[model samples]
Target: MRISVIGTGYLGTTHAACMAELGFEVVGLDSDPKKIEQLASGVLPFHEPGLPELLRKHTASGRLRFTTSYAEVGAWADVHFIAVGTPQKAGDHAADMTYVDGATSALAGHITRDCLIVGKSTVPVGTARRLGNLVRESTSGDVKVDLLWNPEFLREGYAVEDTLRPDRLVAGGDSAAAIDLLKLVYAKALKSGTPFISTDLETAELVKAAANAFLATKISFINAFSEVTEHVGGDIRVLADAIGLDNRIGRRFLNAGVGFGGGCLPKDIRALQARVSELGLDRTMRFLSEVDEINLRRRDRVVHLATEILKDLQGRKIAVLGVAFKPHSDDVRDSPALDVAAQLFNAGADVSVFDPEAMENARKRFPRLNYTKSAAEALENSALTILLTEWDEFKELNPTEVGDIVESKAIIDGRNVLHVQDWLDAGWRFESLGRRSV
Candidate 1:
């Protein structure tokens, strides 16, 4: 089956490459010439753990290709996946639909035969119906374009694996042909017993937002508990483990630390809230707003904890361990680590930052702050250390070694990835969110 994926960003690039890896001919289209050039040369613009190898493999075998022309994308495939971004709009909580609109309109103008235009981007509910009408109106009846909603649920670090082996597949469309085509396209997963869910377009769109909102809520819920735990001298990590053992709550996003701040969770919840307001559902949006507020307050809480550790922040040498929203990825959009580091820098602290992969992106975002090559380098002679993001390399660092380098031997476990006893045993003062200080 010939498949064309529009937009070569994280979602599109991973989807296009993985589709080819599943033994299908795939063409990835992007308007950005530089991105196209990079993909054409087998160099990925962003960092995804296993994507580069997959891109190289598929491009070398000629099963996957990159192009800048929507005309080529329209003509080359029986199915086209609209995987462009729907970023949060400026000065508002709503998502900017320009990329999705542009990609859909471009595809509509070029398609001359019956094809399924599947949306893989997270969008407001009812977007599929609206885009369906747009496609029909643009195609002038020369071609029949069936709009389908198939929202992507791939996490950043585990994107490739999630795409290839999704826990479940949810597809929504009015047409039986659209359903059958999607089944054929995802035959590998279906055969592997991956549950396939068929729903209406609105439900499918809501699924993506709801999934993200729930994940965001889970993180915030724990962080909220972390707040109370802080006052009551309780350990949140142990509480989370006990609650998670029930198998109902399941400790996925229950880690109490710096709350979620990535490209998806923070913006997606706001977008979802804005969508609810657009639909005249203010109550639903209000609840999500609280979720957002809770998530954001965690950042402030981290900052407040840092201030409490040192009586005054002026002229303190602080080291931030990780800057990416999460580990194993270089995406720093709305990153909690960067937010904390920025707050520290603004408060007259001399902050040094390091990340295994996100240092370059962090440097680009906060050039005024110092960037170090390694974790130890960032901690060198620091008055306090902050573990902002829980990268493996940061988690594996010996508290004793870190204590030996820092002048104050004080550390804040922003992500709750450290052993408090180990730091205390090493003769260092350790502070963590929602946990007893040692």
Candidate 2:
């Protein structure tokens, strides 16, 4: 099968490479010429653990290629997957549908033969039905051009694994042939016991948003409890573990940390709320606003805790460990760690920031903050240290070794991953969120 994936960002690139890995000829399409050139040259612009290997493997074997022209893929491939971004619009919580809309219309116009045009991007509900109509009006009546919404459920850093061995596959389409053709494209996954969900257009679209909203709610729910535990004397981690022991309540996303961020959770929940409000159901998803606020407050809690740790911020050198939203990925969009670093920097604290992989991207976003080579370099001669993102390096950090490098013996475990006794045994002043005050 010949597969063409549009939008060579994280989602599209991973899908294209994985499809090729499944022994299908795949061509990834991106509107940006530079990105296309980079991918074709086997140089991925972003950081994903396993994707780079797959890209190098597929591109070397000639099973996967990239292009900037939609017409090239339009005329060549048996399947077209739209994986463009639907970022939150500026000055609004709603998702910007420009990329998805343009990609659909352009692909619909250039498609010369009967093939399935699958939408893999996360979008507002009812987008598939609307785009399906647009495709019908735009295409000639001669060929059977099928439009299906197959929203991607990829998690960053594990995108390759998720794409190659997805837990489930959901397709929202009206045409049986279109849905069946999609099954062929994902036949490898289906044969491996991946559940296939066939639903109408709206249900498929809502599934992604609803999943994101629930995840965001879960994170915020624990963070809200973290607020209470921070004020009163209690162990938030123990509280989480106690509740997580229940078979009903899972132990994932329950670690009270510096809140959820990245390209998906923050924007998706807000977009879901905005979309519901647009449909005159303002009260339906209003709690998502609270979820958003709770998540943001976790950032503030870090700032306030840092301030309390270092009373005077001006001219104090503070080390910020991990600026990425999370570890194993370089994405800093709406990152709490970056935001807290910026907040500290703005308050006249000299911030030396470092992350395992996100240093370059963080530097691009916030250039003025001091960027360092390693975690030790970021901590060198700093009055206080803040661990925001829970990267494995930071989590398993040797407190005694880190203790000797800092100007002062102070640390804040924003992600609540540090061993309190270990830091204290190392004779360093240590504090973590949702723990008894130091």
Q: By TM-score, how accurate is candidate 2?
A: 0.99
Q: Write the per-residue lDDT of candidate 2 for residues 1-120, one digit (tens) a residue.
A: 899999999899999999999999999999999999999989999999988899999999999999988788889998999999999999999999999999999898898888889999
TM-score of each: 0.98, 0.99
Give model 1's TM-score versus the native structure.
Answer: 0.98
Clashes of 2: 0
Candidate 2 weakest lDDT stretch, 10 residues: 429-438
- lDDT for each residue of candidate 1 in 1-438, tens digit (9 for 90 to 100): 899999889999999999999999999999899999999999998899999999999999999999999888787799999999999999999999999999999989998777889999999998899999999889966677898999999999999999999999999889988899999999998999999999999999999998999998898899889889989999899999999988989978899988988788989999998889888988866877888888888889888988998879999999999999998889999999999999999999999999988888888888999999888889999999999888888888898777778989888889888877777888888888888777
Question: lDDT score of model 2?
Answer: 0.92
User: Which pairs clash in model 2?
Assistant: none
Worst lDDT run of 10 residues, candidate 1, spans 136-145
